[model samples]
Target: MAILKQDLSFLKNNVKQVDAEMFTSKIRGIMDSHAPQTSRTVTDRTSSPWFSVESKAVKQARRGTERKWNKSGLEIDKQIYLYHKKQVRGINLTAKREYYNLKFSEVQNSKDFFNLSNELLGKDKNTKLPKSIKSELLPDTFGDFFIEKIEKLRHTLVSDFNHDEDFDDSQSDASTLSTLSPVTNDDVKTTILSAVSKHCDLNPMPIYLLKNC
Candidate 1:
C-alpha cells in the first residue's frame, strides 16, 4: 500500500512536458515492482467478508504450519497443515452459510426471496452454463435451454410437418386436408418418432428434452 502511495505521488508530481507513453510505462513499472509474479498468490485475509479476527489468526496459524512443513518436509507437519487447511475451509463455509441463512430467513415474500437469493449467489456463481450433460448449470441457463428447445420444437412442428401416409387414396381431398391441418403435439411426436425410426439404434434422449411435447 505504501509502495502504491509512493508510486502515485510520483505520478502526481509528473511534469506537463513528460511524454504520456513514458509516464504510463513508469506507472506500470512501479506497480510491477510491488505486485506478486509467482504462480501462487495469497489474497489479503481482510478482503473476504466472512474473514474475522479469529479467521485471520487461523489463517496465520495455517501459514506457519505450511512454512514449517515446507522446510522440514515431515509427515507430522504435513498432516497438521492438511488439518489446518480443512479447518479453514470449514470455518469459511460455516461462516458463509450462517450469514446467508440468517439474512435469507427473514425473506417473507417471493420478491424478497429472489432478491436475497440473487445477492447470496454472486454474479459469477449465478451465471454459469453447463459445459456437458453431467455438468451443472446456473438456474437461468436451465430455463433458457428449455425455452430454446420449445422454440425449436415450434419451428419443427410448423416447418417439417408432412402429409399423413395413412390418408385414404379414395378421398381426393385427404392429402390436401392433411397438409393444411394445424400441427398438434401428437403429430409432432409421430413425425419425431418416424425420423428416429430410420436410425433404429434408439439412442436414449435427454430427460430435460422429454419434459414437454
Candidate 2:
C-alpha cells in the first residue's frame, strides 16, 4: 500500500506529461512489480465422499503390512497383509453402501434425485464437442441452417397472412437530440468503479487495481 501510494503520488505530479498509453504502462509496471504472476498445476480428480477416515487408516495399514511382508518374505507377514487387504475392501464397500443409502434418504425432490443418479452414472461430466468438429466453417454451417429455417418460417407466415396494410406515418414525429450533458470526471470514475472486476489479458492492469487507484 505504501509503495502504491508513493508511486501514485509521483504519477499524479507528472499526470500532464503522461499520455494514455504511458499511464497504462506505468500502472501495469507498478502492478507487476508488486504482485507478480505465478503458475500451478490443477486437476479435475475428486476424492470419493464415502472414503471415511477409518477407510483411509485401514488402507494405510494394509499398505504398511504389504510393505513389511515384501521386505520379510515371511508366511505370517504375508497372511497379515492379505487379511488387512480383505478388511480394507470390505470396509470400503460397506462405507460406500451407507453413504449412498443416506444420500438417497435425504433426497427431497426430483431434481435432487436426478442429480444423484447422474452423479452415480458419471453423466454429470462436462459435455464438450471434439476439437476436430470446431472448425471456422462450423459457425457458417449453423448460420446457414438457421437462415434456411427462418426463410421457410417467413414464407409460411406470409402465405398464412395474405392481407397487407398500408404503412402509418401520421402518428410519427421527427425529433433530434440537440444537446447532451457533458460527462464529468466523477461520472467516469463511478462508471469504472461500478464495472465488473474481471481481468482481461490485454488490459493494462487488473480491474481491482484500477478500482484501488
Candidate 3:
C-alpha cells in the first residue's frame, strides 16, 4: 500500500494523470484482495492465521502503517504550528520547537508518534485557544485527526492560491486567513477517507507501467 502511494506521488509529480489513474485502480484491487481479515472468534487474536503467515510483505506492511501514522502526525503538527505560530510569543516559539523536536526524537527512538501528535493537535484539556489564533487546527477527536488537519490545510492552501491567482486584479493582496473556515470533525473523517480513496486509486500506475517498460 505504501509502495502504491509512493508510485502515485511519482505519477502526480511527473504529470502523468492517465497513468496515475491506472495505478489507483490497481491499488484498489490489491487492497481489496489482500485487505486484512479480522475474526470474530475469541481465540482469533491469539491463534489468527495472520500471526503465523510470516512474509517479507507482511513485515513491510507493518512498517508502512507506522510510517503513515508518523507522516500524518508530522503534517498535522506543521498545520497546528503554522496556524498559531504568529500568535505564539518568542518564548512560545522556542517551547513549541522544542516540543516538536522532542516528539520527533521520540518517534525516531520508539517508532510511536501517534499519541504525542494527538497531544499537540488536540485541545489543551483546559480551554480553547485564545481569539488571537483561529481554532482551525483544533481537532475534536483522536480518530485520524492528524490526517484530517493536513487535508484541511491542503484544501485551504489550494483555495487561497487559486483565489489569489485568478482574481488578483480586483481583490487586494489581503490574506485569506479570515475567510478560512475551521475543519469540523465530520469534515475530517470525510476528507481523510476521500484522500485515501483518491490516493490509493491514483498512486500505482507509474510502477505498473515501469514494470512493463
Per-model lDDT: 0.68, 0.86, 0.54
Candidate 1's error at 113, in angstroms? Answer: 1.7
Number of clashes found in candidate 1: 0
**Is 1 or 2 the stronger prediction by lDDT?**
2
Where is model 2 more than 4 Å wrong at Cα?
A: 14-19, 47-92, 99-176, 190-202
Per-residue alpha-carbon lDDT of candidate 2 for residues 1-213, written as tens digits (9 for 90 to 100): 677878777677887798999888888788778888779998886669999999999999999999999999999999999999999999999999999999999999998999898988888656655576667778887789899999999998887676434546567697869999999868987897888899878887767865775
Question: What TM-scores do the predictions have?
Answer: 0.36, 0.44, 0.16
For residues 1-213, what per-residue lDDT tens digits would candidate 1 score against the true structure?
Answer: 555666556655665556877765665566457653457677864466666666777889999999999999999999999999998888888887887888778879998888777777663435554566445545667789899999999988766555454546785654443456589867875776555333222322222222221
The true-versus-predicted C-alpha distance at residue 111 of model 1, in Å, is 2.5
The best candidate in terms of TM-score: 2
Provide C-alpha RMSD values for all models, in order. Answer: 26.3, 10.3, 24.8
Highest lDDT among the candidates is held by which one? Answer: 2
Q: How many angstroms is residue 194 displaced in model 3 relative to the true structure, after the best TM-score fit?
A: 75
